[model samples]
Every structure is written in C-alpha cells, then in structure tokens.
Target chain A: MLSVNRINTYRIPFTFEYYRPRTLREALEILRSVEGAKVVAGGTDLVVDMKFRRVEPKALVDVSKLEELRYVRLVEDYVEIGSAVTLQELVESEVVRARLPLLWEAVNSMASWQVRNIATIGGNICNASPAADTAPPLLAYGAKLLLTSLDGVREVGIGEFFVGPKRSIIRPDEVLQAIRVPVHPAGYGWSFRKVSRTSFDIAKISVAVLLKVDGGRIRDPRIALGAVAPTPVRARSTERAIESLSLEEALEVGPRFVEGDIAPIDDVRSTAWYRREVAKVLLRDSLRTAYERSLNPGWVHEG
Target chain B: MRVRLRVNGSWVEVDVEPHETLLNVLRDRLRIRSVKYGCGIGECGSCTVLLNGRPVTSCLVLAAGLDGTSIETADYLAKTELGTRIVNALLLEGAIQCGYCIPGFLVTIYAALKSGMIRRGDSTEIARAISGNICRCTGYINIVKAVRRVVAELVAIGAD
Candidate 1:
C-alpha cells in the first residue's frame, strides 16, 4: 500500500524551471527565449500530461498571472473573452449566457464544476481535442481567435484554428489572447447538444447548429460536429445542402449530408457506426429546436 | 520555489517544487486532511478545495503559481454552523458507507450551497452540484437526501 504522503512527491518526477510572468510582454519574452518551454493556464490539462509523462518541458511559462488576458467584455458587436478566463467564469458571465447560447450550453455540459473552475477556454482550444465540447459551438458561432506574440496580434477564425487531432496552427512564440464571439443577429437560433459516456466525461459525439428560418425556408445554416473526425469541423457541405431546401424538406434530408462531410472512427468512447447513427438523430433534433427558436423571438430573452 | 497561501484564515509559506500540486502542499506540508488523493487527474473530486471562493480540484493546480492565494478546505469548514448542519443531515439520512468520500462531498456541498446553486427540495440540482466527487461505496441517494434536508432547514430558518 502507498503511504498517503507519497502522493505529493509522486507528482512530476522530473525537474523543470517554472516562470510566472507578471505581464503579457514578459510572458511573450519568456516564450521567445526559453527553449522547450510550454505555456500553462489553469494548468488543468498540461499538469495532467506532465504527471503521466505524456509531455515533458524544460521550462513552464505560467500565463495565468497575466491579468491582461483574463476578462470577458462586450465590445461593439462581439463578446471578447480572454484566453486566461476560466470555464467557470464564462458560465457565470451574463454577456456569454445572454448572447452566445451555443457556446454557453457547451461550456455547461463539460467536466464537473470543479474542473471547470480551473480549465481555461484557451487551453481547450489549443489542446485541440477531437471531442472538445467548446469547439463545435465556437465553430458554429463563427468566432474569431486573437493570437498574441512579440511581433503583434493576428486574427484567425475559429474554423481555421485546428489542423489535426490534438493539433493546431498556434506558433510557439504566440499565445491565444482573446476569443471574439459575434453577437449574432436576432433572427438566428442556436443549439448545442453533446453526448458523452457521462455528463462529465469527454464527448462521444456533439453537434452545434445555428440556423435561420425565414418564410419557412432555412437560410445560411452553420452546423458543426465534434468527435467525428480528426478535428472538430463545420459541416459546410451539409449547410449548403440544407440552405437550398425548405425547413421541412431539410429536416428530412439534411442529416444524411452530415455523413458525407464527417468520417467518424471507432474509439474508446464509442464506435464509429454508433456515432454516425446517433449524430444524425442529434442533428435532426437540434435543427428542430433551432427552427422553433428562430421563429419565436421571445426565446431571445431566455437567459 | 516558495509559495505563500492563506489556508483557513491563517497564512503560511512553504517551499514547493515547480511540479508540486496544491493538494500535496495542503495534505503533506500543512497536514490539512480535508483533501485526499483519489485520482491524480481531475476526474475525482476527492482533492477538491475552494480557490478564491470557487471549488476546484487542488491536484490539478500547481502550488508554485499560487503564491498569494486564499484556500478553504473541509478541515476549517467542518466547524462552522452550516458545516455542522450538513454533517448532521448526512448522519441523519445515513449517507455514510465507507466514509472515505465524506470529506470531499462535504467540501463540494458546502461550496455549492453557500454559493446558492443548490436550492431547497431541488434534488437534481443538488446532485449536479456535487457531481465532482465519486463515492465508490455509498450510493448517492442518501447523500442527495441529506443535502435536501439541509436546504430545507436552512430555508425554514432563512439562513444560507
């Protein structure tokens, strides 16, 4: 039996220098100077990797102390969220809940309240898990990410952020600064549905839909699915197909197009066959709900 | 690295390795028994603590970064009026099985109820609020019943 005291020293068997930068500029400088350095925020994901020796770093740049990157504010037509803002803070923010239901619902369906308190949205995005619950919603919302480096800031749409499973285009010297979710026009309806082994577990399959119903026809639909491909992807082919059909016809024929756009594989959480079938059902249901909310403008006030 | 933390209203400073977790610092150095190591990952809430008044898994938090933060554990909370009421309710409802998960449950419950997320007679919300902790022995029914009972009394007396 292991002594209770062993849990402390058993963590991270390797030694590494830790840097907690006080300012964003200092953080960037450390990232630029330190070789084999990794940025940690919340430390919920990176620390776990270190514990299992999945990743080993020579220096860890702590971005949590950079206060400039911890905020959620409404500026003009979008809600800008700092990368260091915890998932719990997003759940508690009025701007996120009121204006970004697609993003809001996904955050709520994630790990327990305890993990959410320490997990950052930026970490979720940069980790680039295929089953990232926040990705589908952010993709559906057409959100934008601001990556900061000493060179300056560059904007990348969320859809273009991920390159592969657990991979992204984030440069070594840059940090994800803020996420901008557009305060969509009032006529849109949003739905985010995730299915996991348990409510707190990683997503087996998830879908987010942002639909507009105008005069009984679906227009410019944005559908995103997670845990179906190497990366969370927007179903553009499905959207183009749905937009050309009436709401009733699309509800009947739309889900099939999702199969063409995604290639789910069998994994520990679920089988590819099961994911394909269940994803169709979720897409249909989400479309129905989103259609209803689009017609009933009163649903906009539901916070 | 040296980290300074305020635990249960008392400030203490300790030397921590860069990889040392807050869970290690509290349990080994501070001898705070409220936290336990059920799982090194955040899946199990047995290592839960209140960081700046919000419930978080201490095992996932690096101690070196928490230089001047405040922490609250079940060790300090078990003495308060609300904590006493929660303990009595758990006992009254026969929620203890092995009693190993009780401290983690108590800490999660205290933070949720104190924050007003769990309301009177709302069993579903109560279960969701305390879902962070996993109890391998006692099923959650009696535990949910205990929280419901605590909320009812707190409401009746107009206390939170």
Candidate 2:
C-alpha cells in the first residue's frame, strides 16, 4: 500500500539539466563546465533530498554509467574500490568479506537490498551524512579518498574528508573517484555496531572499532563513532584509554573516555542523552568483539 | 533529453525530463504497469525491477541515467513460462492480498532464482533476498511460502 503524502510526492519538485557521461574524463569536464552542478551516483539520498527541498542543484552529472569508477581491486598494499561500486557489489565480494570484514559489516547494516542495489560507496561518503554507515568503518580502517578534477587528482584522508554534516572537502569541480583502504596486518580484530529503529532504518548510533591484541593486552586500538556528532569522528581518547590494557581492563575504563570525543545533539530519531549513553555501550561491545576476533582471525561475526 | 535503453528485450527511446525517474517512464510512457510506485523513496520495494539482471528500486533510478542499460519489469516477464508458474504459485499459497507489492516480490524472486544465489527451501536466504520489499498487508509468511512453492516446482523440473 502506498502512503501518499501531499507534501512528499514521487515527483521531483524542481527541474535540473542532466548529463550521463560515459567516461571519467567526460564527467569531470561536465562538472567543470556546469555551474552549480551536482554529481549523482546512486540517487538513493540525493533524489529523496531533492523531493524534500533539501538540495536544489542547477544540474546533475550522472556518473552511474561511468565504467572507470566501478571496480574493487587490490593494488599494492591497499584495496582500492572505485567510487561507483554499488553496495550490492561490495556485499557480494568475497574479498571484501575476508579482507575488510568491518566494511562488509557496515554495508550490511545500511539500507535494504533494493537501496543497496543502487547506492554506491562513493555516494555514501560524498553525501557526508553523520550517520553514513560506511564512514565509521572507513575512518577506523584509515582509508584515503581519491578526488579527481580537471586540474588534477588529490588524496584526502577519510578522517579529514568530512567537514560538517552533509558537507565534505570535495570541490564543486571534483568527483570522488575511489577509496584506498590499507590492508590490515595479522592479529587485527575489527567489529562494526549500528543501533537503528529497524533493520532497514537509519542508525541512531553506530560504532566501529579496530584493535590489535597481543598476548592478552590491547595495542593501539582505534575507535570511530557515527551519528553522535556533526561528522563521524575517531575516538582518540577512548583509544588511548584502552591501549596496552587487557580486554577486561579496557572495558572498565575505555567507555568513560568516550565522553570527551563526541558532541551529540537531539534529533527526531533520538535524543543527545540517549546517543551519548549508547555510544559507550556500543564502544564496549565493539571492543570486546574485536578482541575476540583478533584472537581468532577465522571467527565469523555477522553484522 | 532523448534517452535510449532496452526494456523487456525491446529497444526504447523516450524524451524525458532530467529528474524523471525510470518508474514514471515505464508506467507513463511505455505503459509498463508491473512496476508500481510506492514510498517514492528507496524504502518501499513496490517499484523493484531488474537492472542489468540485478534487482533495483526503479523509483530511485533516473531515466536519464539509464541510457544503453537493460531493464526488466514483471509486465514483460510474465510472458515467460516460469514467470507464469510463479504467479500461479502465489495464488495457491494465498500470498496476493491487496496485490500491490506482488509485482516487486515476483520480479525479485525471478531475479534471485535466475541468479542461483539461494538454495531451495532456504527461508532465511529467501527472506534476506526479499528484505527490501514491504508488504503492507502483512502477507510475508504466505509470500515466503509462495516463493518456496515455486522453488520446489523449479527443482522438480530440474530448472536452474
């Protein structure tokens, strides 16, 4: 049954010029020429936002058809995923499930299969939502983004990519081309946790943790929290508190240090207080599970 | 803009607006009614269709971006024998209440069965495959049963 709201209709409220570029160079050229042009990969977020009058770009350059940005490959010491690689492709890749399990987990925790079929990793990051499921995992994994423009290409660390909610350092003329995620060494445990209203709903609080445990003591743990601040942020204080401590010891003290890392605000989905409280719980759970996975790399944990 | 794509095995060229979704082009321009519009957003599965042999929400897809792509909707799919069998199985299992979401589920099941991604009678796999679709009448139990029924038939006939 369709719930038709008078205000929110299927019709896109505004008209915009559209371009479907076949190649990366052509797409970049269109971006450079068209003033106030926005790049649409999946349109899972941008289309809905347009219907709601959240963003009204003068034109849209559709890069969904560009073959240059639709791949997932291992190059050198990193796994490079093209920005246009769909979420469904990420979920079906055995390499992603094996090498980057947290990334797989984050993709699984995202929207439903229908949405995943169209949504791309590049679109998720470029959309720059604070609760973008892929951001926390990329942040913890120390991934770098490849941004391309007519002038040249530049790489930006994932941690510094997002400037604010719905904003990133991406220039109007540049497009996110690919994401380079460093391959983890042995004995590294990774876990991603997302708290949402339903399996398909957006996350209220999501956390991803990567830890290396050696001989029962944690080493250089990294924590990333989402939907708790203006942008997905790494919890350095929490990581420092848990570093060099046993799993049990970290669980006791690490959560307390998270308060200094996140600045949550009340929204329609949840309250700031609730987000703050759950952030700690999720951090503890992620840390414990990550430690367990670190001990046994063969362990399989579903998102 | 003039966009050209293959729809249900036929080449289609249409003049469409930049913001026009594939759902509108299919239903309004081509008269392909199997792809229903629901929740206009990506949340509802009523508008599910096969894009390049993969299941996708047609409502979220812009028609202008689908140039040179292949799309399949249930309306054209029902011409095939397997599609007809699946439709019959749904009625046998009493899974067609209200009938709005049936087209999406059928198209998704068709794609999943063709892809060979799920084992026969694996309800968990089947449920996960169709998790994107919403049946507001709460007819999921029977819908799953209907899919299982079709799978059993396909297995009996030794169809891949």
Candidate 3:
C-alpha cells in the first residue's frame, strides 16, 4: 500500500544508541565495538525498517558525517564514488552524469527529491531490496564494492553482493567504503527504464542495459532487471542470446530469453504473470534506445 | 542526546532521544507546526524541510545525527521575502485547497526557487522540482502555474 493511505507512528518504537563518528576509522571502530550495531548514512531505508519493527539494531553508527566518505571522483580507470555520497549529490555531479549516464538515470528516477537529498548509494545497495532501482544499473555496469573492517578491506562485485531479500554478503563488522565502476570505452551505450505505479512510486519493473555496437554487431552487452526475482539480477541468458546479433535482431530475440533468467512472484505492486509479460516490453524498448544512443553519443541523454 | 539547530533563522538547543526523528523533534519538541507528520516513512513529503539548503524528509532524518545544522521550515519561510513571493504566487493562482500539503509544498518550492533546480518555466521541469510534495486538492495545475510565474519573475529580475 502507498504510505499516503496510513499514518506512521510519531517516533521509533524501539530505541538505540546513535553514534556519529568524525572519521571513517572511528565509525569502523564503533561498528566493531558496539553489539548489534548497524551502519546508517541517509536513514531513508533503515529508519523505516526500524519504525515498522522490521529491523532492530542495538546501536547505529552514522557515516554521513564522515567527510572522507563523501566524494565522487574518476580515478585512472574507474569511477570512485564514496559509499556515503548522497543520491542528490550523485545526480548533480557532472562527472557522474557524463561518465555513468545509466547510473544517473537510475538515481534520478528514484524516490522524491526530498528523499534523494539524504539517501545514499550505500544504503540503497545495502538494504538489498528486490525492487531497489539502483541495483539494476550497478549490476549492468558490473560495479564493485569495497567493504572495510578492522581485519582488512575486501572487494565484492555488485552482482554477487545481494543474497536474498533485505540480505547481503556484508558482514556485521564491515562497512561498505566505496563503489567502483570500471570506465568503459567511449563508444559504449546505455539505457535505463523503470515503470512504477505513479511517477514517485516504487518500481513495479525496471530494466537497464549497456553495450556497444561494433559494425552492426552487439558486443559486450550487459542486461539487468529489477522487481522480477528475489534480487535484482543480470539477465545472463538474454545477454548471451544477443551477443553476436545485430541490434534489430537482438531486439526481436533478446527479450524472449529474458523470461528464462528471472523468477517473478506476486507482490503488492505487481504479479509474477504481469512482470513476466512486462519484462519483454521493457527489454525490447531499452534495447532499441540503447542501440540509438550507441550510434549518437552527444544525445546519450536529452535535457 | 542534545543538539543545536539554526531553525528559521534562530539558534536553539534541544535534548532529543536517540531514536527521535527530525519530524518529532521539530513538532513535538520545538513546536514547529509547519513540518507535518503525514507519514512516518519517506514516501510522503509532508515532513519536508530544508536541511542545509537542500530539501529532505524530516521523518527519515535522525535528530541525533544532525548537529549544528541549519533548518528552514515553512513557518519561518513564510515571513521571508522569497517566501512571501511564493505564497502570493500560489494565492494569485488559487493553488491552495484543504492546505494539508501546502506547508511542505511551500518549503520545497522555496528551496527550488532559491536554487537552480528549476531553471525555466517548463511544466515538466517544475513538476519534477515539486514532485516531492503531494497535494490532494487542485490537480497541481495552479501550483505549476504559480511556480511558472515565479520562474518568470525570477528570470525578469535576473535573480535566478
């Protein structure tokens, strides 16, 4: 149900100690020391979970205040984005807009501007929601995560990050430090589309695609979908089906293979049957747009 | 925990619980009525407020996490020059109905007008700027008109 129908309680029913550390190191130490501590940056997801008693941690280690964890830069070969960087910041950044248009599209299509002001990429990924809009783009981009703990730092690809609903591979003591997406060549094209009940509603189905057309042949195509499976996933079979075909042929046959990659189920927003049907349309349309954008780089995204 | 906020151009210190949201802190503790609590979740922009010149839902913001931050609510903004212009624009266009969502809308509009979020009077651009605020009344036609007027006025004065 939409939140406008019902009013939530005035305050969080359960209480927890809140720790806002000054530095990334201090935040990690607090996360390691506190029992059942959770990392909170924007609180868009965690606060709601805590309010509904869906998740109750003993303490909260806030990383939003850490200056070191708020950055968006293009390193030698990858886009280095701090985990604590807010979605609005990412949306407004010129570096991200030009370098990762699909990510910008995904973030721009997310929750209202009010929510985007404080929502962080790390929280969106960590929440691990099946309908997370950010997940599909990250998965298509083959993004990587840097999870840090007292022991050391470990990197995990975004495709293997989420295990199930509201669950991830992140350890209790580890904090997601940064997200890195390898910079693709200049000729790569991308597309992102999300169909929600309303303009501001959560996605019922979403699709993201990235590929390059070399001499009429689609190469290195990556396709990802959301709200269709237990986790936002890469459509491996669909990618393989369109590997050597022309964009016109891929548009006709790629969408058919998408059914084999996703396992949809009935939910409040949509049903498995409906999702299975809409998935084909979403893929076909995105493949067409991706093909168009691949041919025209200047018009990757229109204002 | 205790924190200080520069709210509506005034600095005040308030003691708040660790789990207390900014919505509760502003309404229950500080007696700021402009910030409404329509939804405890982030979906409803009824709890919208300007934190550091950016619009954010107060319900999802932890009061304990914000210290020495600047907050601007509709209550204080209604008295400012920009706020007065926005209210007048809405009034001239007859944009208010039951008015439950106006406060949040006003804050969002004021923030958008003050920033470069809406550079032109385009309906789609203005609609995206105010998408956070939900008005049950008036189909947002007059609201968009009001913003368009403000955008034109700002453009004429070279203020934006």
Per-prediction interface RMSD in Å: 1.7, 0.9, 0.9
Which one wins by lDDT: 1 or 2?
A: 2
For candidate 2, write residues A1-303 as lDDT tens digits: 565566554778889998888899999999999899999999999998987888899999988868899989988788999999999899988768777888998897788887898999999999999999999999998999999999999999999999999999999999999999987656799889989997889999999999998889999798999999999999998888888999999999988999899999999999999999999899889988999989897775443
Q: Is the docking of candidate 3 incorrect, acceptable, medium or high quality?
A: high
Instruction: Give the Å error, residue A128, model 1.
Output: 0.9
Residue A56 lDDT in candidate 1: 90
Model 2 Cα shift for residue A131 (angstroms): 0.6
Candidate with better lDDT, 1 vs 3: 3
lDDT per residue, candidate 1, A8-124, as tens digits?
Answer: 423777879999999999999999999988889988878888887878999999998688999999999999999999998888888888888778888988899999999999999
Q: Per-residue lDDT for B36-154 in model 1, tens only?
A: 88787888888888998888989899999998999999878888898999999999999999887888898899989988778655877887898889998887999999998998898
Model 3 per-residue lDDT tens digits across residues B30-82: 99988998877887688899999999999999999889999999988988988
Q: Model 2: per-residue lDDT, tens digit, B91-119?
A: 99899889999899888888888887556
| Candidate-wise lDDT, in order | 0.88, 0.89, 0.89
RMSD of 3: 2.1
lDDT of candidate 3 over A1-303, digit per residue (tens): 677645356779889888988988888899888888989999998898888888889999999878788899999988999999999998888878888899988898988999999999989999899899989989988899999998999999998999998889999889999999876557878889988988878899999999898999999999999999999999999999999899889989987899999999998999889999899999998998888888987764443
Q: Candidate 3 — which residues are off by over 4 angstroms?
A: A1-7
